[model samples]
Target: MDEIQLTAAAEGMPNFNRRKALAVTGSGLAATIAAMVAPRNAAAAVVVNEAPVTRVNNLAWALARAMDDWMVDLGVDGVPDIWKAHVYPYSQRKHPVAFESLDRSPSPSARVAELEAAFHAEWAALRAIEPALNAAELRYMEIKGSRPVMGEMTPEEADRLRSTTVADLAKLPPNRASVEHAEAMRAYNKADAAARRKTGYGKLDRAYMKATHRTSDVANALLRHPAMTLEDLASKVRVHRVWEYDGEDFNFIMDDIARVAGKAGAS
Candidate 1:
């Protein structure tokens, strides 16, 4: 994408940008906090010592390596440009780990197994939350869209209906029926919004936003593969049941990624 589009995309990703900023500025603070909160009991210390930072490090390393292998399998040369442009910047912002950190870590095989287990756990959680996330998204669309729900119409159409009288209804033609329906729908939506405010819809909105951002991150990362087209990436997401709750938005994200990738390729 061009500079303008890139800027817009970055602006849209408020959570990602906020996290990036925190990662860059709060690394020291995070370390300090971790140290301060660390358990001092002998038994707790033993458990902590046995927790194996090396294993965690190795798992991270293996995940990265696996990504590299995937890139190679796709016949891409060097690292993905999107990784350099996006993911790597975020990672470096989050933690200034050295290239040799992976080499220094231990338990490579066990770490890989741990990674697989974590993936399964996360997948399970994602499935459990899918229905709620989907419902939240539907409600969010109702509050935000021109057509709040099925059979609803635009505000413009509603205005047209409001301007027409019952005496003029017959002369207003068949299209006016839609306008009348729209007016009724608008009233219904207005009442719905007021009711939603009292019932705490903001929490659901927040949840939907979080889920969208998380799904977008994964979608963008997958789209970075050189051989992956938008359709291919979207199919993979569907097959994996990733972002099943927000299929339409995820498809839009894939399109955005494809646009960026195309621009990058052309330049």
Candidate 2:
């Protein structure tokens, strides 16, 4: 029995092997095994380390990615004419209802009202989940903040420093606010700031996720409606037109929804 250990690293995280044994007994076994195994191991490592690719599950997400790619390819200021020339053609071919015939759809005011109602419903659901979300956020902040700064100190070194600092602070004069006391206060404040910043960022991320999920839900629901054309759906949840100007691009609106629901089964 020959036991092989396979490992890979992705973003500093280790990947453990599932299969442990490959049995072989033949001439030139060592050479054969090495030839077969090295490339496989290397490929596995690369796959594990790579970031997840964005998937387009529906027409909406596909349109968004296409528009984004078009903008990147242009590499200059995005004027309406250029957008019509380069980007709109692709969208027209892919989703004609939304792009080729915008003027024949429902009024923007009517669509906005429907979208607002859906948004309000999702907002209520979010409020219901707020307490649990807040608790999880607090836990993340505590764990992140307490993580000892790496490189200069190990866990053991950090433990030693914390123990010594506490003892030293305890030996100071009880009544007098000495320099040591001030230093300790500053250290505490620094740690608190780090925790607060981390927590704030995490909160923002959660809020964004909540908003995205809500938007995705609304967009998906509208898309699924059998009677509505793509333009009708876009008008309801996207394509915000005001007076003579198109207030928001179709790509921007769809991209926002797609970011949250691009992958299949992302509700």
- Residue 97 lDDT (model 2): 22
Name the lDDT value of residue 32 in candidate 2.
49
**Runs with alpha carbons beyond 4 Å of true place in candidate 2:** 1-113, 116-199, 229-267
> How would you encode candidate 2's per-residue C-alpha lDDT over 25-86 as one tens digit per residue?
34444444344445545755865655444221343465555655543432224322122211
Model 1, span 158-191: residue lDDT tens: 7777899999877854454566777879887887
Predicted model with the maximum TM-score: 1
Lowest lDDT 10-mer window, candidate 1?
Answer: 1-10
* lDDT of residue 203 for candidate 2: 61
Q: How many angstroms is residue 46 displaced in model 1 relative to the true structure, after the best TM-score fit?
A: 34
TM-score for predicted model 2 compared with the true structure: 0.22
Give model 1's TM-score versus the native structure.
0.26
